[model samples]
Target: MATMPSSEACSMALAMAAVEKGTGDDRGMETLQYSGWRCHRKIHARRPAGGMMPAVRRVPAHGSWQRTRGVMVASQFITQLAFTLGLPFLPLYLQQLGVHDPQRAALWAGASATFSGLAMALMAPIWGRLADRVGRKAMVLRATFAGVLVVGGMALVQGPVALLALRLLQGLLTGTVSASNTLVADSVPKNKLGSSMALMQTAVFAGAAGGPLIGGVIADRFGYRWPFGATAALLLLSGLLVLLGSREEFKPQARTQPSRSERRARTRQIWLLLGPIIVVNFLDQLAGSVVGPVLPLVIAHLAGGQQSGVATLTGTILGSVAVSASIGALIAGRLTGRWPPPQVVAACAGGAAVFALLQGLASSVLLLGVFRVIMGLFIGGTLPAANVLLGNLVPPQDRGVAFGLTASATSLGFAAGPLLGALLVHVGLRAPFLLTSGLLALECLWMVWSSRRLNSASG
Candidate 1:
């Protein structure tokens, strides 16, 4: 009697044949065992012979990275400008609307931010799923246009309740950064992902640095509403560019339902990979939040009752750091080739923690501002490294969800920061900064540990 081929051998043979045929064989031979040989042949034969060859997709070239970077940067600049313009003035707006108690004003402000975060957290995953089904570019357009409408409405609203409601709406719709990240992940090659993400992050930091300064100026002169209106126009323009100028490449593929065992295995893998990323983001945000809202107050106190230039001084301190952050991002972008992302992140986080500790001890506005700039440099490097790591770890098919989870985590941190700052203020003005520095130290430890584990596994 002739010995028959084992099931595993049979599957491997079919897979090899399919691969050789180049047509319908694009699906890995791993699927043949479950689907059976005849079904596999039929499915594999339907694919064009040339389809098995790597499809040539257009991506940003090294030369064109600058131009693509410009588009994404401009979009982030306007979006952040809108976000930051409202940040300083929102408390004052609540005060004007009959919230007499300082605690209430702070509470209202915190609630508005919290609701926005909750909305973003809930909607981001849905949007990510949609982006994968549709295209990331299309999602970018949606986010931009929706931001214009929701943020513009904030200018026209009559009361704090309305403003809060509008902010909630804004969070539900405004996912431009998340979409932009998805686009970058899709377009940039793995080797170049770190630099590309860093450049994109610089746009974010630049916008954040400028937004508060511009908002303060507009609020000082034309009132708060004008800043919102200006932001609305900029957002509209950004949306139009994404909708018209950018192109997305998506290859259509037949979807198949996975077996229960396969689904469970994939879920386990995703959780294992995603868990550390989420923890890193949470710690980073928590530390940042510990100081973010209190920074302006710290500057004012350091100025010794000189409230005349508080807004300007605050804007200057924040903007100066942002400028430094942008520079750091640019430098990190270039260094991605020489240094691995985890090392860069750990080093940056360590430096940022040191700066945070220094800021806690500073007695003058100048000292605080100088330290902030240094802190910005470190913080600026973290995002790109995190993004690049995510891009490398997750498969392209699942990138949308990966990025969406990241966006949601960051938003949650953003929302939580002010509240944490507000709470810490009850103890003392400088307390939050010191606390933040401690948290960052812990985060640095985590980063180092996680990085080593990942590297060891890969090695």
Candidate 2:
């Protein structure tokens, strides 16, 4: 799956833009100037009334925010790296946890993953709404600290049952990326929101692409348990960084709750954006998850059932996809710059659909990897496109909840994906890929139709 960008990147980009503008020398600041200009122009066009925040007001805040953003990006990168380090070995881990039978191990993996997704899906929205009230920084801190505890707890668990419980708890407590994104979205100038969001997305993909390769090496040399302990330590550091380094200027919504009619109207508006974006996010993840539980096994079967280096190979495959996705995200950011988000979204969804189907038809491991890499490139673009649209669609105050709701959709898809994958495996290993491709095709069609309706309405 593609990584969500941290809020830190947005803030960092904004601060750099501020610095570049003040200097006005154009000596070696093309990147900063481009980002700043992109954000400033877009935000100004959308919100002409706000004009620009005065330089005097923008400077001091930008300085503080920039430093915090730097720390946050570092911390988030480490956190993502740590979490994915051993995640590809979950089925193997389950086997070690006493599920000796291959089918049983697969089922347990799906169940554990499903429980975590279910728990996260249920809680994410509440936490998101809470962030709006308590502040996004607070929400992120909460997720990080809780992440340390739950992931660390995984190291101590001895059985599938215990591990499943810890995974479930992990979902409930850890949404650091989402919270951070919400905070960053709120902090940056509206005009630059798209660029800021794009940068954050790229940062996430970079970390995700690199983390698994290292994690695989570590897992092979050390053991599965070491990764969990290491993950906890990283989360603790991430939490400390956020608590000490990040700053936010959150303005709580009106104290009085909205009337029922107003609430209904707001909810309706939220769905207009949420409907397609959430569906896209869900479908994308569902497609990914369908293959997630059994990919290692599939690879092993393709490699003539070589069990010795399966973990490393699994990491290699997963890492390739992430690396390709990162490249795709960069391309998507540019595409969004030129075309409407919906058009970009349609293109990405369609590409992913075609590639996912090809993956199902692959007869060899090398071909599957090739299809996966190509699919990752397409899937990676979907989020940045959909995300920018969401950022534009939702009002500033509602972003935390909006992202939270997106997270919920993601969790629900993740929850269902493994279970579906497990079921498909019973039929045949390649079946999941076909199922995924079909789902993505339907999602693509719906998104195209919806975007056209939205465009026509707005026009």
Candidate 3:
């Protein structure tokens, strides 16, 4: 439960990372040339010296992809639900484990979450690279199964160190959202990439938005440990769903591997196109996570010190934000069809900033929840817009690593945000919300400053 982010989904590591479904040499090479409601892109990889397009073979969907997509969506929903079930309650659980002081519990929560994100940041690209070698389905299985062990172990932890260790293990082993997206993108047809990915994102959002509501009731009634058992069970079920339901037609492309120097050169070029996008991804995740670990603490404060029902209130508030976020993401995706992605991103970030400020100033949990819901709606758009901009600009060939790096950047933000939130909690419960607002404002400013440059460069 390490708060091991990016939402992992919000990383949009699948931002057309899915159109990778090629039979033979097409394996993961070509991205759907996504425009509005369209396919993906390809940063051409190792073009032949004879001036030929990198031989990309498009595999027809065979009409089975939609069925496959339905299963994948179910698996993703369950996976996200399992992750969120125990997440918002981590500090509460820590308090149960003897970190009784609210600030101390928040700090412990942040520390463990920071480590989990650090582990995930370090591992995301390695996993992404490995997925290229193995089948994407295998990576998806690995990620989901890893969750079974991690969450199951979390249930048995008796102290902070044990919890921290499990969280590190969670980061090292699990990245269900990212892995699942790659596999789905690999299995679904090119034409369906946008809809499939959007559905997948919605699954993540729905689970995140609703799971806490359920977890809150469970924890309030049964104690924090029960949610762990429940989460583990749900993860196991999700893993089984993916294991049995999804099919992978990916064939590792046969190609002479590029030398390290060549790979490095490609990475540098990818970074050039990706630098602005990466910053946006990082900020988007950071802005979201800053409030994540701190929210329950804020709720506890607003209620005049934690006594009872804090988990339920916290869950309600977090759930509201997530519900709004889902709507925001859909709206953002639609608006991208009409507006420049950067403009959409700037508008969303600006709106999120205003709401976040309002959230910081709220005196009651209901008002705080209301502001957070609005902020969620706006912040939710940031990722999809940024990802659209990325998918359109980064050559499809480089996008695998490009998206991996974005995941890494997102993970780094995930790692940093909670720690920042924890430190701000020392200032006051309101400080984290204010800091989150500033981050959103800065995110908006970054988009405003770079929108024209990014668009022009892509042109």
Candidate 4:
């Protein structure tokens, strides 16, 4: 734990010595208590009339909070792994659903991803607002259970159109990752928020890494549809784990009626604080999703082998990217305290832009895999950095809607990426990567400009 600042320490020492001197200066002590609390809500520096450090009383609660954090992280890992299992094979699934032409497959892949994203984008804020009123845990349960239904329904669809519709519904109902993140944000101490968010992000990357490798093997052995069923089972298991292992004490905000001027001012303040962060979040995901729709086909073309062999090779590439992302998340979690998140985000964006451009130029699968892994390392930091910044910028009571808005931005970016991919893939497989790189580069410049503007305004 960090010690109090020098001024706070001095006030605390004087307050204690005064009490010890048997002065019984009630008004002075009360004033000190109020001042201490005002200076920092996390540190309860003042003591009772005969007292010791009141902050010490909060240690046991902190320990419990740590335990809760552990449970949520584990749950997040399981849920993410389950959720992402089908993603690597989405284009393959489209192939099985009656699309035969590669160009059309790419377009459909992008369209399906965009459809899901649009649905999720529409629903995220509603779920987020509901989470604040109900409980985050409830939202997690709702998402996982909905995943069981929506993903499982994918198994029953007969064509690409039906599959896309189910996926759209899936987005409407499922947001387990977001729900788990909200839970983590609510549970951790204020000072440890970034670390906790980073740790959760690592779990996300781990699951993303593991799921593709496992799902690829499963899809190869049992066919594309089995993975959906398997994903449903995993979602069911995750829901059970959350129910049995985690606890949340939720208190709904009191309803208040505000004047139009006050509401307008609040809305303007929110826009000023969150607008840039949301755009950055969206554009980052958009850059990454450019590869999602056509990666398997690219691997298949490079490997020049049976479908089964291609599936395995594609999994290897996907897993490598995810594993690199996990490593990046670990590094990002450590660096949040040392560097400002916007600076980190800008650096990561620039790095991703460079690596993505390199990926576009690669001629072989091996070279492409290497570039993607490097790109993943940079791409991984973006979300956690944005989340940490959002957490700090918004009050706890409003964070659900704030994160929801970010989620919407992310979905919008994700929706756009594949569409861009579909359109560019006709030019060549390399086009999407180059295009994404250009978008990311543009984003980096914008973020740097925004950060400088904000800094100058503050100064």
Candidate 5:
């Protein structure tokens, strides 16, 4: 956690950290007692009495948090795998519904994804806020079980229009990633957060990397709708895993009644501090998703008349990109160590932009796959650099709100990108690819400008 730079940030930190890491264990409950809480200079550094990191007295909550981490990571993998199992085939599935034309199918596919993204964007903050009040585990259950219904219903949809409704509902009701992350964060101490977070992310990549390929094979052999049923079952299993394996003794924060003026002032402060970082997140997610809906159309086009195996082929390409992206994320730390994060972000965005353009020009599936896989490497770098900026830029106490806004931005971006791309599909399949390149180029230019501004200010 970054140090609080101002008295306001320090105060906010104190308010937010009250019931930090109180959870249940195998033998019994481990309660947090803030009775002897003090900021000892010997233990850390001398800070003001109400500075960040107020020491707390607590019973070591056994190894339950550790176990919780394990269970949650597994749950994350299963949940993500379940989601990707059917989502990536939306365009192909649209053809099965009634839209046989590739261009029209791509449009509906993008619409489906956009509707879902819009719902998630609208509801994310609401659900995130409620997770504090109602409980994170409850939110996770809400998301998981909701998916069991929404995705399962997708299997029964007879038309493209009906599918779009379910997609939107899926977004409004499900946010397993955000809910699970919140639960894991609340369940563990701050120091171990990095490892816990990394593990969770690894699970996401692992599941995503395999899900498309596996789901594709299933679709080819059985049918498109079969994967949807499989996804629902997997989601059920994921919910059960988290429900039975993990425990949360959640303690909600004491309600604060800040004045209207005070709340407005705080909102301004957050915007000033986090506005650029939030934009970066939004654009990053936007760039990543813009090509997703139309990739199957491109693959089918390149494959000529062999529509029979397009599902499997599409899945392979998507799975490969996911794997490459994961590897890129893993190596980003080393790259950041050698240069400033802004510079790293700029470099990677530039690379991604170049590769995205190459992808648009590729004549064959193999060439397109190569270009996308390479683009994924650069795509992966952007997130880690943005995260570094967040750590450096946002104060510890203020990060919760910062991250919450970022999540909203991400959802909006995800919703916007595909819709924008789908609109571009009217021009040509390659138009979306060209658009992805343009977005990444803009992202690169922004980072470069930001890097120069930071360097000049420091100099």
Candidate 6:
């Protein structure tokens, strides 16, 4: 038996003893006495006044997370699809709008893209911090609905400047992906995080792949404006889905401020994990976008300068690569569920680098397409693995900030890639591809070395 205390402890313990012995009719009375004794014990122990204990809050499990994921995925799919669908034809639209100079057209298009990315990069972290305070689902819903309005309004813009301004606004408002990632980190069990993140990556890539094909067809048949109109409608519908289908359940943390040392430790941890992710983002975007803005021109040149047919062929190449990538993402997701994320990421990076290098070596259009398809497969798996690795590294409370930082890194890489590709085109058409491939190879080495270090530390 446990030892009982003397007179003071007995008085402190009497109420609890009475409650233990009390019947249903006497339970309330004994509970009240127990509260009084608890207060007394607190005073004796020199604890905070009132002796009130904070309630243990239970976080929502699979069901809530899954529902939020579904809504978020739907919203992302539609908005991203709409945005990507119009991207391939934006320069063409600019040219048609009286900016016939190729240099000017390219400059304007690049500026619009840069502005959009800058807006997103600047706003993502702010929105993320807000989500942590208010509620993630609410922020997601707001972003989705705001995207609907901004993108839909983009259809009515009369000039390139107006379009660029709207695009910037759209980026500032739409942060659904970042919020969704944070929600998943909070709601999903640790064991299933890799698979869930993989599924998210698949959705993003699949949307990206399908959008261009559909947009190209629409642009070829209907008009440039028609594609934007269609995209706007889709975004509106997606926003509705998010508003109707999603629910937010906020759980606030205990109110305790961190010390300077604790804050420094956390900051160090964040930078340590963030460094590799930033590198991965840069390399991934560099590899993907190095071939992007110029692929149509490449196809046109290959097809003996038939610019009219380039859109269709470019769409075909993009779609083919995306299909391969989707399959790779699914496979990687399953594999990573069983394997460590860093190992999977390193393998994917190495494979993508080899295929990207082969892209620069292709002597025929058929061979280039084949290499691109292979590259897509490997590249498709990289983002999912990176996200899963991040999910594992960060704590739930800080996940929103971590995801926002990642979004910023990705946006920066994306913003820079097209410009780099354009600049390299001055040297040679294949220079960008070769350079990106080399960078990717370096990234692969980094991943391998980092994974080894992580393993050694863990062991």
Each model's lDDT comes to 0.71, 0.75, 0.76, 0.77, 0.75, 0.70
Highest-scoring model, lDDT: 4
lDDT of 3 by residue, 221-325 (tens): 999998888888998898888778776666555455789976687556556667888898788888888877778877878898866899988888777777888
Question: Which candidate, 1 or 5, would have the higher TM-score against the true structure?
Answer: 1
Best by TM-score, which number? Answer: 4
Candidate 1 lDDT over 154-241, as tens digits, reads 8888888998999899889887888998987777655567777887888888988898787777776776677778878878888877
Give the candidate order by descending TM-score: 4, 3, 2, 1, 6, 5
Local error of candidate 3 at 391, Å?
2.9
Query: Tens digits of per-residue lDDT for model 6 on 83-106?
Result: 677777666777766677554665
Candidate 1 runs further than 4 Å off = 1-70, 100-103, 456-459
Query: 68, model 3: CA deviation in Å?
Result: 3.1
Model 1, CA-based lDDT: 0.71
Question: What TM-score does candidate 3 reach?
Answer: 0.85
lDDT tens readout by residue for model 2, 40-73? 3211111123344221113225676666566667
Clashing residue pairs found in predicted model 4 = none
Write model 4 residue lDDT over 181-271, tens digit each, in one string. 8887876776788888888888888888888888888888888888788888988888898888877766665445778976787687677
RMSD of 2: 8.1
Evaluation by TM-score, superior candidate among 5 and 6: 6
TM-scores for the candidates: 0.84, 0.85, 0.85, 0.87, 0.82, 0.84
Decide which is better by lDDT, 3 or 5: 3
TM-score of 4: 0.87
**TM-score winner, 2 or 4:** 4
Candidate 5: stretches off by over 4 Å: 1-62, 187-191, 333-344, 384-402, 448-459
* Distance from true location, Cα of 147 in model 6, Å: 2.2
RMSD in order of candidates: 6.8, 8.1, 7.9, 6.3, 6.0, 8.9
